[model samples]
Target: FCFKILNFPAEHIMHMAIGTSLSIILVTVTNSMYAHHLNKNIDWNISKKMFFAIVIGALAGGFVSKDLAAKTLEIIFSVYVTLVSIKMLMDVKVERDPKATKDVFYWTVGFIIGFKSTILGIGGGTISIPFLTWRGLPMKKAVGISASLGIPIAMAGVASYIYNGMKISNLPEYSMGYIYLPALVGVVLTSSFFARIGAKLSHNLDQQKLKKAFAIFLMLIALKIFIG
Candidate 1:
């Protein structure tokens, strides 16, 4: 939205790299505390193992994105976003088996999700939840674990962007490398307040309908970006 409509002056990848980290930080802080208080079921063993790899992958992703051309990065990101939106619309049913997997497999999954999270500017939930549930975790547990992983991923992503953009010249005012402070503030303030409301409504609303609507919105955003 910022890049296509508001004409943000920074590279699209840079804006996403910064915005995603900041938003994840705020959302994770609020949601993690809430989930912990409520004892939201989580697979701590897998989560612990994945955390290390996820962090490393996030850092690597940020650095990798920094080196890509703006137009190339934008095209890749738009395609990925479009696919994720389509996945949401599909909303296929998944069963939980609660089986075991090799450490190597878990680490691989963690790294892949983490790497994509940074490039796509997400908290990894979209990919993580499906992967976890497919691997025998309950839906609720998968979501909780995904939320927990966001902390490390966000930290690594922010640090990498800060380091990579530190010496870049001609950034706009109130910018920390790729991070635009004013944009971050606006997003955090609005999302933090509305997120709780959305959660509440989710319990009462038709979830499938909501997901479809959100997916349509994302598709539109992707199309807008692709055409510009």
Candidate 2:
């Protein structure tokens, strides 16, 4: 939104990357910590396969993004997000997998999720949770693992954005590589407060409804981007 639709000034794409990474990092840490405190199973063995592949993909994505034209990137991201939104909006039933996924499959999915997360400047939860659940893990456990995966994805993306923007000329003021300080500060402040509220609300809410609402929201954003 910032870069493509809202027309934020130079380095807005990088700013979005860093800002999103920082915000998701905070949320991921908090959620994963709370889930861990509850003795939830995080599937560390699976996470190991995912983390290794995802981190590399995240870095590669960030670097690859640096070379794309702004319009091209915007179209690609908008289209991808739109398709994901549409998929989430549908009420598709997936059979739970009782068996563990193959190592190659985990690595492949992890890399794709990680790369897309960086390219989209969003966390992998939306993609990973569904994938994990489809692979036969319970929803809660899948969410936990996805949250944990955010750490490496965000870290790699931030580093890559920083590296990509390090020597770019004409970036906005108060910038650290691709990270715009003001944007990061603002998002961090709101994310800290809202994360707690969201956590609390989840316990009381109909998650299916919430998911539908979120899908609608994403659809609107996608429409705006495509129209722009």
Candidate 3:
């Protein structure tokens, strides 16, 4: 959306998304931590394990992104988001694989989720929820764990993007590293208001159908980007 619709550089938008997402994530996580009803499903052990591994991966991704060309990042985003959207459209029912959670599974999946989420400027939840649910975790538990992990991933990505972006020259105005302050601030101002509206509306909506609709929209946006 930032790149194709908003006319921003895709790579810089990646950095911008990560930076802005952190603020929204902080609010959500904090609310999750305090919500009494949601407390029962949180597995701190799994969350911790994933958190540590993902942070490491996010750091590595940040360094790698430093040398990646803007055009390359644009292509990467287009392809990856397209694939993810298609996967969402498939609506594959999540069946528990009783043996899916091995001791090392968290580390391995966490690393990949962190790396890719950072590179693509997303919360790892897009990948984490489905993977965890398929791996025998309860859906509530998966959501809880993934939400907790978003904080660390975004933090690591933010730090990395800032440090690396500072070294580059001729970046746009009001950028701290690659994060465009105006865009980040704009997101902060608008996201929370709509998020509340979305949350309230979700209760009355068929979530699966909504997700499918959203996935199709994303695919259209991605295809437009790809064609251009």
Candidate 4:
């Protein structure tokens, strides 16, 4: 009985790691395609910076304990993200202005995205998209940038989880900290193909519609976290 219970956490960690990694790949590919066809003017520098920032934040968040404090933080982040999504949903049109996006804003947002990604086990692109679109980036650009940003977030989060798991005593077999590799694999496999599809679809849909759909999705996820 003790052995069985101990094995449970390992299984969960495997699942999470696999799910998140695949999610990162799928989202990245989707965003790349969307940006290519929809937004001709791509700023690779900004995308790179956002990606690193997300990684750092995710690493930090992943190492933290999953205790009350962590849970509280997660709740706060979920509420904040949900509100932002709702606000974006209310806006019918996104004003596009490349000049309006500042370096400071990107970094700040990247940090938030990274932290959220690690704690929530989600791609920061979900939040980054709305914020970037509101700041004047085209939806395509925002999605692309957000998708790029997820790479670092996943890398950092996964690494940290593995590191932490190694240090802790009595971890289950196949355990790698907070991540569940098996679930991670499952999610990644399923989501990657769909993410590519999503990216392709983004080209056919208007920015407003995409924003609305994304916002609703974010809200639902946030709600689930809150309930959990």
Better of 1 and 4 by TM-score: 1
lDDT of each: 0.72, 0.73, 0.72, 0.63
TM-score of each: 0.86, 0.86, 0.82, 0.72
Model 1 TM-score, 2 decimals: 0.86
Model 1: per-residue Cα lDDT over 96-158, one tens digit each = 667788999888988988788777677787788788888887666776677678777877877
Off by over 4 Å in 2: 1-41, 94-97
Ranking by TM-score: 2, 1, 3, 4
Worst 10 residues of 4 by lDDT: 10-19
* Native-to-model Cα distance after best TM-score fit, residue 216 in candidate 4, in Å: 3.4
Write candidate 3's Cα lDDT for 1-228 as tens digits.
Answer: 563466656556555555545545545544544341245656787888788889999888878877777667668988987888888888766666555466588899999988987787777877888888777887667766776787788788888887877886756778788677776677656664654455445446876797799888879878886787
What are the per-model C-alpha RMSD values against the true structure?
Answer: 2.6, 2.7, 3.2, 5.0
Q: lDDT tens digits, residues 165-217, model 4?
A: 56656554544554445545665667666766776666787767767887898
Q: Point out where model 4 deviates above 4 Å.
A: 1-42, 65-74, 100-102, 168-173, 222-228
TM-score of 2: 0.86
Give me the runs in candidate 1 sitting further than 4 Å from their true place. 3-33, 36-39, 199-205
lDDT of 2 at 173: 71
Model 3: colliding residue pairs: none
lDDT of 3: 0.72
